[model samples]
Target: MNNKKIMIYGAYGYTGELIAREAVARGLRPILAGRNSKKLQPLAEELGLPAMAVELGASETLERTLRDMDVVIHCAGPFSTTAEPMMRACIEAGTHYQDITGEMEVYRSAHAMHKEARDAGVVLCPGTGFDVIPTDCLAAALHKAIPTATHLTLGFDSDSGLSPGTAKTSIESLGVGGAIRRQGKIEIVGHGELTRTIDFGRGDKFAVAIPWGDVATAYYSTEIPNIEVYIPMSPRRAKKMQRMNRFRWLLGKPWVQNWLKGKVDQKVRGPSEEKRSEQKTWVWGEIRNDRRGERRIGRVVTANGYDVTVHGSLAVAEFLLDYGGDGGYFTPSKLCGYELVEKLPGSGSIKVGID
Candidate 1:
């Protein structure tokens, strides 16, 4: 029992439930946890695991529940709000912590906790999700393939849809515009500031600069001087979307956000069981070493984005179980080396294309 104990915070949410399901199937007993007991109880029973109620805002209550746990998989959404408090509780209780957070600001905050975690001898890993894991790991792999690489550009085309929580958070970030790293400094750019079209087999798809967590991860992972991450949007439509986002500042009112959320929730039907079963994501990355007069490009395709995220969360859990006690807050790239990248699940559901 002691060896099987793992807590799945936010277990009732879309991604959290998936993680709980995956954990149970792997013979790990997950302690289903979240703010609402009534919501988590049935899930725990359905999965045949114990359930505990936890609220991030209530630090004392959170700490008490986290005690004696071998590890915790935080699947809460919009991590900007939930990660910090939960991390504090984990450090206080000496429990190893991992989260699927992709928010750059949230990652910075978690990274700041490294010293405290190290002193306490507890592991803290953030961005163990689709947001940065595959990208970060793949970036590391590319850097190794071309040792002199100095810049990287990553893009992807995902047939999978976004979950409600993910959509909500994305809409919130719309007004903030996209961010990129140029010459080793973080730069914020307005929507459509930089646009290009890249062929992804299906056709030439348009992409725009987006404030993805990769900007933060890639800098720490590889010695690339410039890094930019983009998400595909149809060229014609991309322009329209940019226009809308540029004016998002006017809609900053809470009521406008609520309205947008409702509209988005209705339009973005998260990947259905059928969709998840069929959806795939293809990612491309290019590393250029101008000094060496060489460039290496790599590509990877995987099952549904959410599933990849679950896999990453599990990877973190496994890492923690094996070697996390040394402590310190760390990103995936910082914790594991090239070998870790190679060991990740890369079966038929995931394929890597490199050149």
Candidate 2:
């Protein structure tokens, strides 16, 4: 393990707590950090870890505080607002950075920072969560099988509720038009532009294209030119999404977004501990070369999606410690490959192979 001290920034959030617990279990002593020292104090005490209370907007102070830490597992979400400062601070502090974001904009911005990260000699990686770990690696594996692949399609279904952080992020993404990779470039597409019934080894389920992070990361990892990502949705919710696209302008309104955010605040907190243990996350991916009519499919079913995020993020952070390479932006598979998924605890419960 990299022996450098680890800091779990936003460690008071739902996902941050999970990462902190797992980090401690792995015999790591992480410094829990977030905006609320009072909250961080109790959690850090319970875990026997130190705590730091630093707001993301405090750049100089944030950089100074992070100077002693070797890497930071950033957990605060709605990453459009939270990610950039932390990333900048990490680069300035020469501390490696990782986060569990599935936001395409954030992924694209991070990818664009590759040169800066390399110059700073610090690895900058995002989507260490369930977002791209299984999907990105599946794309990488398929690309390895068919190196000439020209197009890719990915789908996922999770029998779990969204965390508060995820809910907020989802709301933030609602107004943005859908995205797909076309000719190796990110392109805007109408919501529900591509819908398909994918047989994920269990049964046929309806999936609709949504701007998933894989649209960005898979291309970086596999070089597949055309890509579409789908998520399982019921008929009503699917139709609602499509219909609302016509009124998407309303979603971006400050007042409208604020109202929705208020409602989200009223909702129950993230999944219960019981639900986290019982739910399963199923992901399906396929790559193909239309010219050659060649194709490959892969499936992964892991413990709970949230649990996988916690473990997967920690695994990536730990791996970066011992990694000896010029630091730059990377997808999970590009950095570590399928071996990461294979080694993660509870990932043994995951199933991945050709269809």
Candidate 3:
């Protein structure tokens, strides 16, 4: 049993509620927190867990609220707006912080605070969910299988619908070009700059490169010098993404971005529980050393992305609580070795081999 308390910030959010339920089922007592007491209080009551209503900008109050918590699972959206303040509060409170962010910007922010986190004896880990869990694990596994790996290509295909938070993040990044790591350096390219046909055991599906979180975390996880992350995109959407570069300025404009955000808000709020249960996610990863003329490929068939996110995030919080580790920045694979994938619901070892 953990003596320290766990806090789930943004506990009223969709993913947060899922994580909170999972934590409860696992016999964990998590404090649900958000900006709304009405929403938070009910959830806390329903789950028989503590609840706190605190605004992020209220630094002093927020820090005080966080002070007693051993770890915080931040589930807020876009992360760009929420991560920094929450992270600062966690640091000041000397609390470990984890989040389900897939944004490269957030990963960089958490990474930049590694030294500070270590000094404060606080673990600052982000991307504990669908963003990089399976991919990071795959990257680590491939690197283990081929220690000399220098290049990585990861492709993900999911039938799950996007959460409102995820949709918001995607909207904010619509104008940004794709990103990749080249020779240990970060580089940006047009959306369709790189495309590949990935065979994830089902059939060939064309994938377009995108600025995925793995482009940031996989580098640290596997030390691979070159990496490209892809998600399957319909040809129409692929063309649209490519055209975004030409109208980058337009898309980046506040009015346009806000209008797009409004449209997303009007859409449905992610998939239903039934859909989440019925759908699965397919992930493909490859590691290669062109110099050695060797390649290894791995595929993961896991529960839908959102389901994995909830399980992945809670599992991370539990692990950190059970076995306190040296405080520092870490990715999923970095915090819990590649085998963490096997422990995740609906995820097991894949048959990886040379191709």
Candidate 4:
């Protein structure tokens, strides 16, 4: 009975289910929504929350649903495909759109709608989860520390694995190589083309550049002309990732994607409660302007990605409700402020220092 008409689309997925349970714990009754009622209704019934089932392919159904929602915490993915329609529907209905997407493509595309969202008086923000929240905030904090920063590098290593939806996104992108921002433009490069030693506040780890969402969001948050983000990968895995470039065509096919999805569905159920409690997620970022001879560094530690997603998603929804801001396209840092990462329920600590 929170009286906030928030809807959790894809609420039956792994992270979505977690968000729904935690939303109830926090006294917000979110509608359990997704593409299937057979799956959604049970969880909705168990949680005593209302439920809705609608296909994104059905424009009328999607539009009708959007008209009823005040805000949507879109848990569906790979959002690269689902987002455009949903975003348009939300804008048309004047409903705030928030999603847990970390896809660099999604962020770039969403950023293009700043004016429309502002005109519609609705907030359109994605990367509400670990995908870029910690790193994006770190980038913003470092930017605030050194406004002249011309280059930014962000990285993270988490003691956890992907959920099914996350794994599917990863599989889809396996053929897409990697990307980095250079002079404010996104540049695509070979997979594992860039590797560096990063100190994620814990210790040194070999991290390789991947198409993380921060590559897009950090640029907007900091106005930095160059940005790259990484995650720890062992030598063998790095080599395997590089090898994937030669087979991009095969890996990107729909049937092959489905086959890999089958593998992921079999193996990835995400971490359990005990594992989530035991895990630690770390993010590191550096801001530098060689011409100005300045350097700033920031690091953060947080809970498992999924846990942070649960808390971060709801936290954002709460912010839109309480902060009462004019709507526009926003990065996590822009919408919630740089302290959002540190203020998040499960995010551990943040440290910024001059280097």
Candidate 5:
């Protein structure tokens, strides 16, 4: 059992609770923490874990609490608000930091602080969740499979239900428009502006080009010149969703956003125990070496998106505990090589299907 004290901020949330449960099962003592002491108390007692109350916005209090911990796993969503301050506290305290943030802006901000983390000797790694781990890790594997590959395309299909946090984040990114890298530059593409039909073997599903954090990470991780990510959504709903997203400019109005939020809250429900049990996720990647006139494809499949997120977080925590230095900010793709991520225990749960 590792004696390092792990603190899981936002432990009362769905994903946070999953991480806390996994941490305990792995023989790690994780302190349940969040802005609400009242909620944390019950979870702490239920898990036989201690509770620490700290608000992400409260820098002084957060910093003090983080100082005594070896690592902090942040599971809060809409990371745009929480990632920065939490990162600052971790860097100042010289403690390892990790989060499940899928927001591109949040990742960029954390990446910017890499120098500070390196200087402080603390490990700062974000996106240790379902958002990019499975996809990013698979991208690394595909690149290795074809050393000369210069361009890559990746896609995911999952039966796992969406959580409220995920829905909110999607709504936030609406109207912001999807972005993709083209000819060595980031280009903004309207929702549904770029669409393709993907056959996942389950059936043919329509996928739209969407902005994802992988665009940045893959460009930096591999030699790929251009990369694109697609997520499958029903065609009938795609256009409607796209239209709403395009008008998301109107959501800037408080009343419109609030009304939309209420509607989404009612319609977008999180996974239930039964649904989570039946859920599975699959990912596919294609790598091409235009210079050499060759193409290679790779694929991976796994069960339970939330379970994968928990496993990914544990992988990061173990890496931080064993190999990470005193203080430094890093993305998972940067801290460890792609091979290391592929070799992770649950990684093999992914099965490859290619032509």
Candidate 6:
């Protein structure tokens, strides 16, 4: 049994609560934390673990709170705003940091802090969960099979609907349109600017390119100079997204963001336990070196996105507590082996074919 003090911040949030409960069920007791003591305390009490209320904005207090903790599983988001400050504080406190963030910007920011985290001996990794873990693993596996790969593509088809946090992130992403890695540089494009037919092991489906974390992460992991990430979409919905690109400017308005956030609070309860049980997510990856006439394709089917997030987040957090590492920024595949998927309880299987 590990004795390290593990803390899950935003412990009462939908995804956070599930992770906290799962931690307990696995015979681990983690300190729960968030901005509200009232919300954090009851959950802590029920789970028989310690609790603390510390605002992420409170730098000094946040540093102090993290100073003694061995690992912190940051389950809060719209991470674009929250991840930076927490990452800074963890580096200051010498605490290892892990967060379930899908935001490519967050991953880039963490990677940029590699030197600081390394000097401070803090292991900083983002997208430990559904955000990029499964896909990142697949990318690494494809790269392994086709070592000279120059172009990598990843896509997913999930029936796992959004939680408030994910919905908000999607709204933010929509406003910014799409992103891809071109010749090792990250580039932004219009919403739904790229689309292709992809066989994600089920059959050919129209997939539209989106700004997924792997556009940044897979390139970093495999040094594949060109990369794009996509999600299966109905042709009608794909066209709708393309149409929405015209008004992308409106989505960034403070008033518009506020209204959308309010609606999420009122309507998005995330998936219930039974609902999560029934849902599944599929991740697909393809890598090729056109110059070498080599190509590889792979896919993985996993539990509902949210449930997989909880399990992946826990697995990485526990791994950090037990395995000492030279601190630095890491993708899931970079830190944990690509076979990390094999360790995920209900994450199903990864299948690959080469040509």
All candidates: CA RMSD in angstroms?
A: 2.5, 1.7, 1.4, 1.4, 2.5, 1.2
lDDT of 3 by residue, 1-355 (tens): 4688999999888899989998999888998999889989888888999888999989999999998998899997769889989998999999889999889999998999999898898898898899889898888888888898889998888878888888878877767777999999989898777887888656888888988889899998888899999877677878877877898777878899889889887874867788888988888899999999899999888888898899999888888787566887898988988888778888867668865
Candidate number with the higher lDDT (1 or 3): 3
Residues 189-239 of candidate 4: C-alpha lDDT, one tens digit per residue: 889889999888778888899888888899999899999988999988999
C-alpha lDDT (0 to 100) for residue 303 of candidate 3: 88
Error of 2 at 258 (Å): 2.3
Candidate 6 on 1-355: residue-level lDDT in tens? 3668898998999999999999999999899998899989888888899999999999999999999898999988879989999999999999999998888889999999999999998999999989889999999999989998889999988887888888888878767889999999989898877999998767899999989899888888899999999888889998898898898899878789888888999998887899888888888988889998888889898887898789999999889988677998999999999988767877767788962
The lDDT of each candidate is 0.78, 0.84, 0.87, 0.87, 0.76, 0.89
Q: Could you give candidate 2's per-residue lDDT for residues 1-355 as a string of tens digits?
A: 5468989988988899989998888899998999888889989889988898998988999999989988899998778889988998999999999999888888888889999999999899999998778888777777777889898998878888878777877787677778899997788777776788998656898888988889999999888899998888777777778887898888878788778878988984888778788887777788788998887887767767788899899889888888788888988998887667666656643343456
User: RMSD, model 4, all Cα superposed?
Assistant: 1.4
Task: Mark the regions of model 5 whose C-alpha exceeds 4 Å error after superposition.
Answer: 201-204, 252-255, 262-267, 324-327, 339-354
Per-model TM-score versus the true fold: 0.91, 0.95, 0.96, 0.97, 0.91, 0.97
Order by TM-score, highest first: 6, 4, 3, 2, 1, 5
Task: Tell me how candidate 1 scores on lDDT.
Answer: 0.78
- Candidate 1: which stretches are off by over 4 Å? 1-4, 200-204, 262-269, 338-355
Task: Give the higher-lDDT candidate: 4 or 6.
Answer: 6
- Model 3 residue 340 CA deviation (Å) reads 0.9
State which candidate has the highest lDDT. 6
Candidate 1 C-alpha lDDT tens digits along 1-355: 4474578899998889988998878778878889899999999899899998867998988888888687899987668778888899999998888888778887778778889999989888888877777778778878887777778888778887777777777777777777888898888787767777765435677788778888887887786879998778867766876787657777667788789889975776656667687877777788888887788777666666787778778877877777734798677867875344345454132233443
Best by TM-score: 6
Candidate 4 Cα outliers beyond 4 Å, as residue runs? none
Overlapping backbone residue pairs in candidate 4 total 0
Kindly provide the TM-score of model 5 when superposed on the true structure, using C-alpha atoms. Answer: 0.91
Candidate 6's displacement at residue 203, Å, is 1.5
